[model samples]
Target chain A: MCAKDETSRPKMAKPGRSFTTLLFFVCCLLCLLLTRGQKDERMSICHLSSCGSPLADDGKVYGMCQGRHGLQVWGRCCVNVTENTHNFTVGLDLSGCNIHDEFFQESPLLTLTHLQALVLDNNPITVLSSEAVAGLTELNYISVPTHSNCSCPGGEEAWNHLIRSVNTTLCLKQTSTCTRYNEACPASSSHCVEDGPGLFLCLCKEGYHGYKCLRQGTFPMSAFLAGLGSSTVILAAVLWVLLRRHVKTA
Target chain B: MASISQMWRQLKSKYSIYHVFVFLLTFFSYAFFHATRKTFSNIKTTISSEWTPQFCNATEPCLRPEKIWMARHLFDSSSDAEPFLGWLDSTFLISYAVGLYISGVLGDRFDMRKVLSLGMCLSAIVVFVFGCLTEWIHLYSQPVYVILFVLNGLLQSTGWPCVVAIMGNWFGKSTRGLVLGAWSACASVGNIIGALLVSQVLDYGYEYAFLVTSAVLFAGGIINFFALVPSPKEVGLPEPEDGDDDDDDSEPSGEEDENGVTPRTPLVQTDTDPPVTFTQTRPQAISFFQAVLLPGVIPYSLSYACLKLVNYSFFFWLPFYLHSQYGWKETVADEISIYYDVGGIIGGMIGGYLSDRMKKRAPTVVTMLLLALPSLWGYSASPNNKTINAVLMAVAGFFIGGPANLISSAISADLGRQDLIKGNSEALSTVTGIVDGTGSVGASVGQIVVPLLHKQLHLDWHWVFYFFILMTLLTAVCILPLLVREVRSMKCFLNYQLRRQAAALVQDTHRPHSLNS
Candidate 1:
């Protein structure tokens, strides 16, 4: 018999189909949420190796990965540089590197504005200089920690001094000493603050503030906060209906 | 009520040609819907390229545009990339399979016109919105961008069911193949448009092209809303009442079903003829949740997924294959591949015409599919050599693309039996959704699996053609028996009985093909 029934639904259906339907929707919601959750996860990665440094496309670079020697381009290139948008971090896993200026020229800690960290713990970074870090004004952490026999004139001390010169408020000095000297040092560019040795923090420059401290905003905090509150409730209501009713059906 | 109604009987009035007018209008509406639905498939290159520089290529610039989910993939590891592509495709396929069961229920329970229109509008909006998203959001991870495209797939699922519902309502047994085949051809046409337009836009900017294509579907949505009429009954007319003048038996009172609930006409009417019937009202509507469980939906849904795997693989990979195997760029490869679509247009017309004339749309699909299987082999084995493979591929396109529409459109129509079921044409769309959604799942599968196989086979990307060949063969063999039943349903196939009835005229070999029965 041709049992392709159009007239009536099968009576006494088991609970199995419903379970499947529920599972199906659960998967869809999870996919949507997971995709939404991974917004700004970085695509640039530095594979740690002994001889090779991650290739940076050369000094006058439009794309960061353009000149890096060992660095491979992945799915799509995400870095397009602009005035206020440079949150990409250049990580140095010198756990096994014989550091040459190719490291500096390629990732010349100087050019990166929002450079966050530089780690050369187990590397032979014998000759370090300020010119090597020509453009890196906004570096926060430069850990060359635990050197058995360190180089450079002041060793860690000269590096500390370099951090201090970048911003008078920033130094290799202890926090207690810095707090005492705070009054003596006039905050010239209030946007700049010293964080560590050869590292200072850049306060989102000005007229711009977002998650990565990237996007520019027109309104102030109080007005934006008020707008946020009303919209939050509305967004919540809409999400609830979409997730609850439509999710169940869609 | 209106003067138009009152004056209608006085004016030169015959409801039959009005049937023809509605038929033509409905057919065109279905065609336009197909055109718009297809607008997105071709633009893969554009959207992929546009989102590329913005997203950091996750690993490499301009990899596979076929990998819908990999738009979110972030790592540069090729090892990780291939497997993840596979996983993502599985995700899409699983969701598609899950979605299929309920799609039928949704169409049946809801007003299919509104449902289909809403789906198109939303798809357009989602695609357009996703297009605009290239400008706004810049989250560059495997998870982030993948979600956007996944949503795109989910929304796109609505198109098949909607179009199917429309096609089912408008055609019947005699012309089902021809009509459905034409509808499927529209799908190919949409892809062709999608490929050309997307490539063109990508050359300029990826964002604008995506936005434009997505937004254009709104036009289709609007047309579908005004143009889709459920059946002839919706406009206060009867079926085309073809009233062919050669009936010998005393006629049954066709008027008996005027109350709109018609019983199934018994098969005893003639063992020598393909049964002909007219539209009768459906018993009632089933709710969306309960519709999938209504038997045959899941089985058909599974077969649809299998059938789609071959087709979808071709959809996503054909351009890339052409480019890699031949010395061609993405744009050139994509453009040239459209010849396949052109052949599809011809194949669909031919298949449909044959099916309608012979009353065996399903068999036409089986036959073309069988022909396509070896063509896939020929295409895969000899892609570079022009004399053999290129011609073979065009031939493959003819059969493959032709049958695709014939089965999906006319077969779905025959399955719906709108003539038997009456006003419940809405479920037809849901069944369509289930079928096409199943196919989308397969497409996602092919997108992932073909690439993985290509890598494994270590053959130059010709593995895509190979995959199509194997799958096409399997699908053909599996559906061949279905064709046997399909042939028997043909009024012409009952040759022994027809010859017995007209022994005097039996030797007359000059019977017009149209009157073979």
Candidate 2:
């Protein structure tokens, strides 16, 4: 009876479920089309006369555009940005820009072959990826929300992933705690850092010490004692010679 | 404790051990002197790089520019700065040369050990002050540095003459050549050690180089005072019996003798008689002019002057020249230049050994000088090939170092034993002083001229080599008259031998006839 009831319940709910599924499929199709259209509009806008212009900040959005003069469109600076001009930009400061994976993948940053520094301060960018910095051959430094101490979900992991993927130095805002900083250790030294039980501990190599392995290990006490011992013997010999000369003269 | 006299007697029984100890002491002491002296040359590149205005300024500040004390005043924008650097070197060398004669005379008159210790102590003080001027004192005044360096130079001059005299007292003329030649290598060894020390410490700071050198010199001076037995008589041992044509009148102080003491001399001997004593009595020391008039003294002195001119030029300018000509790194150029010192060591030993075996000091020196000429030309004119430059440089060093070492050591020792002096050993220091002093003057001139030609005259490196070649040729020529005298005397001796042989034959024939009659 239980089995029969269970089977009958599914049969009754089937039609409704099917209708719902169909409706959901149609909604997804519409949303996808709309998203495609929006993407097309965004790309068209990027390619147009103000292709590299920074997006306007209406007390909300913050983005930089390679304007006629330089990187512009920061609140008030956006107004003076000359229109109908494009430049081969070298740097992009996207401070306070609300960015995501899509913004990273589709942003004009990719077009700037000469980009050196990327500033993403005060941003809610939680989906940074290697693709964002992939072709930036000249990129040397990158700044992120680490400075703003913004508490975004998976923000630390996002920065870690991005930094791991890129070769340049990632300048996290001063608030970011070093989880696994390799820079703490010099090339000649080995070091270990202990955060917690599950956290990996960095162990320094021989003849080096400290969490960062900055200080070189000193000579062993035995070596110092040996040096002292030899020096004493030599001093004694010198004394013996001097005394002997004195005795002879006397 | 045993009575000091008893202990001393026990130690003196092992007189040969004392001899070896004294030898080692003099060797290391002079080497220490040279090492300290060379600290400046070894770190010259570091000084120039660290202090040059081009290396630091308001617009383009150097790494830790504040740490440099002399940068703004001594090495900055004035066009005269570079040329004045040459003068700094000259100040030291000229003072050293002038101080040579005075120190030599003092060395002869005073206790050698006292003189050496005093010199070492003063040098250490000056070098330490030089370091402090840059490090702690921060006195960037150039003239102050020059004055300190001049004092250092004068003190350094005390090293060579005093060490040679002490060693002369220990070893006789028989083994003097090889012993002094090998021993004179203290210069090159000290130079190499200095280069290594300065190179290592330069990473920390340039001032440390001078400080470390001073510390070593101070320690060495103390050790030298304790360990050095300036004369055998002071240790109650008989004099070494190694002088030319001198017969031993005193009992030979053999190893088998249970007691170390030898009896007093039998009698006073005339000047015409063969020297028959290794007596410890103070002999009349010759005047400086008399020492200069000794056979082979003037020629060897002149030759040494030229040789030193060439040597000092290389000493002061080789690394700089290599850097400018080939764009090599300063450290690499300095490392390569050290090989020249290695060649010098080998050359000095070879020259000494050959002179001893051939029993002719002048010819050996002349041959080495002549060989150096071609090597100098090649080293100067060679293309910027590292391998070729290194080999030629080593070859030039080998030849240049040979005569330079021989003239100052074995030749001076030989002149000091001049037959006219009648075995007055104290003259050794004076003769060594005169020869090395003249050489020091030439070294001073070389230190100035190399820079003048390179920077002021704006001549190519080839011109520097031309100066070297001319000096080499002149050195060989300076000794030419002596070489001629040696050859002419050899010819006369051979002729006399031939005539005697013929007369012997006739006498033998006459003896047979007279016996039959």
Candidate 3:
């Protein structure tokens, strides 16, 4: 009976210590989850109202923008009216704006990723290239000035239909740029995706990343996290024991 | 079982457990205070980039996909963002300076352990909410950020006074210099820890840096609440004698010898007295006005103000200067700048030891401050070689940081326990608060003035170094009166010692002659 009592006491003490350690880890995990679960509430829109000039309240641009469900006319740009939701520019009209070719060289319009229909009918832009309109992935319809030699954003082959009117040229039926650029990517380990109207980016497939996507396997994040957590706990325990011994001795 | 119990008893008798515990507890508590404070400086660049509008240009034609927040639109241009960031720093420092006076009084009146731990916990929450939760929730209001920082500043002010007063309560004058000197490194250590943690998790996002630091601070606060014993009296141990009673007797006479030197006879007589019992009743807390009037308080505080201005200017601008002047990467500049803090740690320990050995604080401080001028000038003149820059920077740090640490910690402790206060331990916190509070005000002014000198005045970086040299000279000048007194006292002390030795030798010869007769 005496031998059994001594053996059972050691077994009981082992679980008690482990239980507290487990509890500490559980609390840390809960804190991390709580902080991570918060909803992102940032307004996504153009920073300034005047991309150039404010649109008249009763003008054609305002009418066209107001007809959309969540769109509003801010200067020359059509952006989301709602401040809370995550949204971006969907329409822009720069007709008769007198903007030059240098404007497209480092265009702010590239940030309007959700832009669908763009009107550039009366501008003096002469050097618009596929590179200038890059990152405008959702653009489907675009009207260019008649005298300018600017092609459709991704070139003539990218659009399914093109109409040359008396005053402007309209391009429609935008096709995916990835289909044409897929061959540019590494064959086995990577895939190509359209980043913008004329830009295609090659992304490494699962478990591959490096100069040529030759490297394999992702970072062992779980192992690293586990190691970090356990080490912190161990260090804390050691410090506690050391300090406690000093207290006990005195 | 009997042998084990006997061993435990032997170990208990050998160590002063409460002393070690108090030191570790206060050291880490103040360290956590500084760690939370340092998180903002480390993440400033990242915050600026995130706040300013990004444009896709000819060289870089890709939109940042993860930039899906209003904070990106907070400023239309980088120029607008820079001034606002500067304002945040000014607000924190100004509020911190104001709060120090209040915290000092509060620390004396209330239980220090509660004040310290609670302040830590609240400050941690403020930082976590402002830097982390705001990022998570994408809250970009400027006023909210300012308000949170103000509250954080006030909470942080509780840290320094409480920790210093607690150290004063535990340790006596004999070991205060060395102990507090080493303890003072907690700030530099905290800054290094904060920088390392920020750099480690900063690649993930700036918010992660805030999360890690605040979490560490909160954990430290919880430990402090459980473990800390604010004074030796609480644990039934006799409080260490402050050594002020000996000075108390000499100060009243105000007598000088014929050569116009204060006699050191009384100071020598009390050196061999038995340890006094802890029988004096606790004194009431001193008012701010009274604390300011204490001997050595004004000189030290004024000197500290000038010294802190120079020190804080280097702290705030070093990385920016290194990056801009040398064209180094921001991270590389930041990593290199830590050499300054490492030098500070070593300088503080050496200065403390030297002052303790010499039994004079003001002379040691004045010497270091005087030396800092040359070091500062050398750092400015050196070529842009990384090794040379780092070495000169460390040398400047050693001279400047040494005196700053000595004044704020050991000197503050000395003044708080001076004989004029009649050994009132309650006044330590208030005295510490006054000196450091004044220093913070100087630091806040430096933060604003340094930028104005560079940007508005167009003095350039080299010219600004000249301004720092001027400030170092002014710091030495402020303490010149105290230095003179300490030197005079030292001369008298040496004279007294020589005369005593001669008298003892004569008595020995006479005793042998009398015995022969």
Candidate 4:
């Protein structure tokens, strides 16, 4: 009778168990689809515009896009495809793109954290504030229209060299934004460090932690040493006893 | 009361008790010395940041800014303290290399226990004053730091030769490889201890790190001064037998006599046959020139230098490489780099055991070094996988560090008591110093060259790995002659064993026929 009941229980629960199993698979499928959609949205930035037949000579940006290995030109952008999954935008040439101050304020280019060489020559943009290049820490070479009065992101002092040519004003070697915000960390136990262009972070000193860096104290050295010392003594005594027979005495 | 007295007498009579005591005392003494040395590297970043003038502001106002009011204010505008720190390191290395030669001569002449304890105590005080007292007193002078580091380097130089000499006196050649291999892990252990102690106290102030390490080192020095037994003769125990007579016990019977490779001349008679009065004669210490011309000293020293260059490059640059390449946080990178040292400790033990089993040091060292090339190359080529990187780094570390440890500890001990030295244990300290001093110079050169290759020359980071591979290859090349000799001796030994077994089998068959006749 017990065997018959056990055999019948599976028959009775099969439909409901199958239904839950189907639901679990459906939920997993939905998660995969959502992640795939997000990935597509991220990759769409590369295909937003088409590349010109003869790429405009934007100096370093053009050279990087054309000459660098593992980097391919994709719709006016030089994307790094070395990792296969994550395509980092390393160089972007936006010559004659009709970009303005508004485009700098809320452009897709701001999402490219790894952007190094950016060319915005022949654009309508006149003034580029520090906020416009806020997250671009790796940027070393940037070009603006020659008519623009916008100095470098953190001003001329923050850059190594500034060149004014016929079509563009190029800023080379943008030093860290920490140079301008050197005194940002006000607490005695904190220091300001550069995170990116126009970005700074406050880090607590070594022993100090928690809110405003007030917490302090060192490792429990006394307790630790006592434990280590006692264990060593015991082990040494054991070794002495074990090797007694082997030792040659006078 | 009677039982307690009897037990005390029994313990005192056993020579093993003294052996254990000396091992523990010397082990901790050297570990303390290394811990103090390691503290500087661990706290370098904190020191550099504190040195920067910009660190002085409204709220954090640099501690005693008036103290640093010099005419030049060299670090006033620039936030980078790397170049100054580099100069400090170079100053220490230069002084340390020079001091090692002098310390070697002094160690053989003086009581080793006194020399070791005094050096440790003095170095502790210097470190404490340089690191901790200066912070308390608000003394911030560049020249003063340089002077203190130079002094500290000379004092620290006394540590290695004295400890190695003392160890050579206590341990005989039979188990020297296994014993010293295990013992040599003090350096890596010291590094870990320093890092832990510093990390614990760094948040309060960098000075606390120095304070703790110096205190520990000072305590070790005091203990060593009171309890250390420098040699067996000091306590009226029998001197250990050198490998000359015991070689046959561990190997085939006829090998040593037939090949005449290693001279079995018992220069110092063992206590086994007749009780020789040790007080009647003492072996004189060899000079620097004489020690240098010893059979295996020059090649081993050169090999050690090349091996140390590669070892120290990883020691100095591993964290920086991890942070830059993998974008790991500073602390994470530092923690990950420790796996290399862990691999080193294991490798040293294995290398020692293998050399002891084969009764050959050079072959084991050369094999590990040759294997290191591929591990290094694999480490460089492995894609940004943390597990793979760590495993390969450990493998590279094993291959590199195994031979380096063997050469410095057991090989140094072996070379010191070689047949040419005539069992004059007094020369042990000088031989150890020459090898280690040359290795320190090589490490200094590496510190300069590693930075030059990647930073100054503006080459890719991969160039550093290529240079490491080259260094590993050079280390093997330097030990090639030693490897050849060891291999030839081993072949001869094996042939003798095979012939003896064949003769025994023929004798077994002829015994029955003779009985029937």
After aligning candidate 2 to the native by TM-score, how far in Å is the CA of B137 from where it should be? 3.1
- Lowest lDDT 10-residue stretch of candidate 2 chain A: A74-83
lDDT of 2 by residue, B1-517 (tens): 5788765654455336556666777777787777776787666554554444433354331321122222344566445455566677788889989888878877887778878988997898899888645655656677787888888888988888888888877666555677888887888778777767776665446676777677677766776676676776564455654443222223333432634444222122222443333344567677888788888788888888989998877877788889999999987997888778767767887888887655567778888888898888778777888888888888888999767877888778777765667555468788889999999989988877887897799997888889889999999999999888776765666677677778999999899999999
Off by over 4 Å in 4: A1-183, A187-250, B1-15, B55-74, B244-247, B250-282, B500-517
- The prediction achieving the highest DockQ against the true structure is 4
lDDT of every model, 2 decimals: 0.49, 0.64, 0.72, 0.73
Model 3 lDDT at residue B421: 72
**lDDT tens digits, residues B243-276, model 4?**
4332354442233233232212222334354433
lDDT (10s digit) by residue, model 1, range A1-250: 0111101111212246886456544543554455442212332223333536443332112143445543223222213222222324443334335665466554434334444344454455655554454345443345453333333222344343433222111223212222332332213312444433332333444544422222343424355346544554554354333221211111
Q: What does the lDDT come to for candidate 2?
A: 0.64
Off by over 4 Å in 3: A1-250, B1-15, B56-71, B77-79, B243-281, B515-517
TM-score of each: 0.54, 0.61, 0.68, 0.63
Interface DockQ of candidate 4: 0.04
Off by over 4 Å in 1: A1-250, B1-97, B139-142, B199-204, B239-283, B286-303, B383-389, B418-426, B457-467, B488-500, B503-517
lDDT, candidate 1, B120-141, per-residue tens: 7776676665555644575545
Q: How would the candidate models be sorted by DockQ, starting from the highest?
A: 4, 3, 2, 1
DockQ of each: 0.01, 0.02, 0.03, 0.04
